[model samples]
Target: MKRSKQWDVRGAVGFAAFFHFLYSCATGCLLPFLTLYLRHLGLTAVMTGTIMAVKHLVALAWRPLSCILARRHNKRRTVITGSLVCSAAVALTLLLFPPTGNSTENKSCNISQLNNVPTTLRPRTTLQKFSPSVRYSAEHTINPIQKHNSTEYISAVPVNISTLHNNQSTAETTTSSRSDGKNSSDVQKPSAGKRSRSLMKREQKQEKITKIQYQFLESLKVMDTQQQMFFFIMMIMILWEILAAPLTWAADDGLHEYLDFVDATERHRAVKPWKLLGAAGGIGCSGILVSVLYCLIGTVLHFYAYALLMGLAVPLAALLPLYRHKREHVPGAGVKALQLVRGDSQAMLCAITAVLTGMAGSAVSDFLLWQLQDHNATELQMGIIMAVVPLCQAAFAPLNGCLSRLLKFHGRLLPLAILGLSLQCLSYSFLQTPWTILPSQVLAGISIGALWWSLEAQSADIASPGTELAVKRVFEGLYLDLGAGLGSVAGGFVVQKFGINTLFQGTAAVLGLWCVTLAMLQWRIPRQRRINYSRLLAADASEMSESESEQDNDWLEKAMEEDKGNNNWRRLD
Candidate 1:
């Protein structure tokens, strides 16, 4: 039986690792480039931002409701499979909306022209000046005799120099004879009429050229068709997020449920390493694939790759073990969690920090690609850059244990993490080349990892008995949903109004100031008054175990009274 249980644990772990890998592969293929793809479709910055913002907002609102429905209906596996299939189908539909008009061509032209405007304008003006004479000679110099085929027209031609001189003398004699009478007006009329005709032709040709140039320039702007397409694409994205967002929460719940059933809850931490590895592999590999496809076809194949991976994961999602155990529903769990957070000043600070961190992280993730594209970074470079972040996170994850010990001793991890985030933001503002930004990603990975770790530790510390999960859920909502949603919208507006550089610089300044405030707040607390929840919880657990083994009823009552007194002391502290 022990061997059988061991085998079951191994199988569950292997299945989970593979499934997470496939799911992450699908997500990594599309999400990093989703904004870039929108911009490629000729949507303005503001429009792209709005679409992204709405996507996140819709996901945030729908995730909880979807999870609740799935749980209530006992359809966890069904929801997971259905959402993946639907998401894959909807993502594949993006291929149907090809870029309209010569927008891509015009955008490229605009960029080149903007760069060399001073040098290019001189040649264009010179060509315009010389075009009319060349056009007139080429188009209008046909022989009159050839068209008329008449003896009179043939006789007017000067076949030799002597005939040309004789014709000129005859014209001069006629002009002399008519110089004193109304016949003089007849002689000048033909010359004036010919000049007016030539001028009219040149003007017409110039108008045509000008109209063509105007049309070419206008193509760089978003057209009505593109606007309609944007709206349609935005709707599809929102729908995609609505369907796909719940998968993460549901998968987590399912994994925990399975672990509980197996009596191997300690293996929960063991699963994260696999998740990180899978995510890093997926992101890195997909990026390279995208670059290759782009080089071969001159178009992004993000959605196609996403669809293929998602389809592969759909079956695995169905196969996932999601065991349900009968348990009594706890009422007012949310209210109790809220009260716990409200009573703890440290928890409130941690919650605020989570919001800020989410905002900064979201802003960077959404717009960093925009900045890189502006620098003309290739798909491969972007892929490597993105892949490095998760890789770094995984590499540095072990250091978190050491950092936790140091933080427990020094209590400065959260503030330092905030400072690191500020520096990362500042670094982005000064980015000159895509490659130069690589090192900053290490800082980013570390800062974000530490910040989240500290927040989770703080949450665990502050949570009251029986309300641990609820408190953690509240923090997750703050960090991932509410904070992320607000960040996307705010970042979009900032980028639209002030440009990407300003957005980065301003965020850095704000975060730096916030870091200082947090440091000052931390310094104000007296050391002796601080509670060590980890030690307290450890001691409480040991005491409870000892009490359970005791046979004396009076000793049990005395222990209960002492526990109550300690709880009151904790509240006061």
Candidate 2:
């Protein structure tokens, strides 16, 4: 029986890590480059922000359904279906809308040229400078070679007009002979008026064509392309949300539930939440690192093959969860929606923290990309610079976890995470060169790793028995989504107005203030009053006698056997 429990634990954690890695890999490949891609397509910063914000805005409506699906059906099946759908939608989007250098400008200009200008009305100022012989030859007696090369007429007419001007006395003699007693000035005046009128008409035509081109370029930069691209992106984002939300929600709830179960089975606290969360973070970091490499190589080479390969990674990683082993199921699903009204201080804190984290994290990509462009970093250097955050995260997360285990302190790490967040913002704000990006990324890794592990475990511990754990998880997810959306839009405006460095400075200031406030509040709260998983799960921690324990184990096994055949999901009241 103990062996069976151990196997379940190993399988669950391993599968969870695999799922996170694949999800992150697919997401990393596309999302980090999404804003840059849209800009490349000629969308302005404001438009890009609005479009990116929509990606997260969908989560507001979608997150609740994720909880419902996870609770009301087989989570494994739900995860698989979601993974497949998300994979297909994302793959189609990238493949169909592959990037082309200068395609946007070329397309816009082509349309303008077709609609706004006439082919025959070439701007002809140079013709007035031609001498009589050359001008006559150019206009009336074209050589076969000159006819073959139409461009020669332009240069020939200009030089001949200049020569004709130099021989003005001969031109006057010729004109006087033709005039035959009529005043030459009188004959030439009307012709001069006609020439002036013709030049004026030509100039007006040229100005009109220039005006049309300018308007087309402006429209391409600011408005309509963004609208078209927004709708296109929304189609993909909606499909992605429909699938990814449920699977991710289920995984989050499952991991937390598994932790509770582990606590119930072990007499002593053997599996810590920090270690579990850190491992997940580590896997995510590795996935992002690989994703950045692929994105850089593909983008620089201007090929979709590398990105498509990354998109294909989604389902491959998803298959791990479908391994035909007995999955650990946590019993009881009730009205967790009711707990939303309970207004627990701890839950509120967790939700607020998630929002801040989302705000800080979501816009970091845009800022980093902006910095790379400003500094003129190469594609490979940009990829490595972008990858620094995840690498640092992977290194520090488990280190923090191991430290937590050794120090026997979990709540204490929350402040450290906040500190890391503050430092990251400062680093991004001040650092100008590629070399400086690494230090900031190290801070980011620590901040993100610590916050995710500690905040989640803390949120779960505060929930009462009647609460739906899935709902609790979804609440955090929703806040994060909201924050990210708002941040992306706001960051776009900030970058447009004050530049990327200012955005980083403002972010740092906001986070530093938050860190100080969180530290002060944390200082006031007693350690025992705060969350501890062991204490929280210890309600079912009572020891049974040897014979009773055997009977309980036998009953649990029989119940599991019965449940194997009846896999109906429970609904919350």
Candidate 3:
């Protein structure tokens, strides 16, 4: 039985990891570089933004539907189906993409461009940025990216994702502040007196810097795991705009497409392009062969045509997770414990991530499309700018060991990382046009790195000691998916209503609030009482300690008895 269970764990974990990686590559990696693709396809900024944002809405809607299907049928089979769906969507999008429209003819694209704003996002984040326990008082809700001049004092923090990208800790390298760059909150404050710690008998007082560090560390520790997860998920969605959102954001080549369409119309004017006997849908192509071709060829394009491939990636992303599932397995003990977290945490993360993805991605795409509606950017230039964040993050994340060593502890590391990202994002509140969005992508790597590190590290701390490592990995996966779903929905709506810059600042506000929440949690929720488990799961730490001591004494007594018996026999002999 144990052997079977062990095999199940190994199998489940391996398959899940495979599915997740494939899904991630298809969803995040591909989409991160999508912004430039939509521009090449004749999409206007608003149209591109809408396409990017709307797709997320579809993907978000699909996540639960997919979840349900997975539950009712074989989970692995469902994931497999999902992966195929992504492939199909990619093909369909490519085939249906309209030919150039006529300039003289009245034409409309479903998506529009929004200029005067910058930085779009993609839909694929997996969780929130902070724990739920952290709450922001109404006081810190300042929106730096707002048009109102009152809070405009907060200068935009552009992320140079290209900076130090060669470093292994992508998060550490990217989340840094510009040397002369100022955050909205960097205004000098009245100095506080020094303090002393009980741990150190020295009479030396605490420095202001030490106080901030202490407060910051405490704040980082206090955030509720749930809230942190929420913030982490949301932040990733916001960062999603770093690249792919631009695919939808660039200025529409309406006239360019119209000219091409006019030429096509002229060519076909003499004899209509008639539908062939075996034509699939409205296009003259076979469905089966076409789909397979897209899946195979699309993967190829995704690797090579960084800009053009995103249009395909948007739809394809929806399906990859499904196929990857066939490879997934659950650990022996985790299968049971995961049951406890199956719906609540998973659902919350997915829902929030989707909404945020839409919010950030839609808004930024709109802004960029508006900026580029005249089509000033060449595809290559846009692609490189969009490419920076993911490229930097991918390069840096693996070097977490080196980054961790730089920090004194995880508490310091995670929060500093979070703050650095927030500051990087906040920098965008006041930057000028054109170059505005470009710099922020660099920061995305750091923000994403910080958010991911905190959640994975903290979840490990929270999981039951008996649970296998697989449980936490699953926890990370589910939360990430949920967050991605929710972020898309939220991001889309927010972009539609508020401008893209507002969405960016709005995200910063959320991050700031998360910071406050962390502080509150640290102050109130004592370090010993981290997870507030139900009585059944909450094994009192003191009780466990006592039980362990008692067990140890029993073993000691048994050993002493044996030793004494042996000694007596030897003495008698």
Best by TM-score: 1
Task: Give residue 328's error in model 1 in angstroms.
Answer: 1.9
Model 1: runs farther than 4 Å from truth? 1-7, 100-223, 332-335, 409-411, 525-573
User: If the candidates were sorted by their TM-score against the true structure, best first, what order would they fall in?
Assistant: 1, 2, 3
lDDT of 1 by residue, 489-512 (tens): 788889989999998998899899
The candidate that wins on lDDT is 1
Model 3, position 173: C-alpha lDDT score = 31
TM-score of 1: 0.70
* Global fold similarity of model 3 (TM-score): 0.42
Per-residue CA lDDT of model 3 for 424-486, tens digit only, reads: 556655645434655676676555555555544555554564442334444443433334444
- In order, what lDDT does every prediction score? 0.71, 0.56, 0.40
Query: Model 1: which ten-residue window has the lowest total lDDT?
Result: 150-159
- Give TM-scores for every candidate, taking all chains together and pairing residue i with residue i: 0.70, 0.58, 0.42
Badly placed stretches (over 4 Å) of model 2 are 1-12, 70-79, 94-223, 251-342, 400-411, 465-475, 524-573
lDDT of 2 at 534: 79
Model 1 RMSD vs true structure: 18.6
Decide which is better by TM-score, 1 or 3. Answer: 1
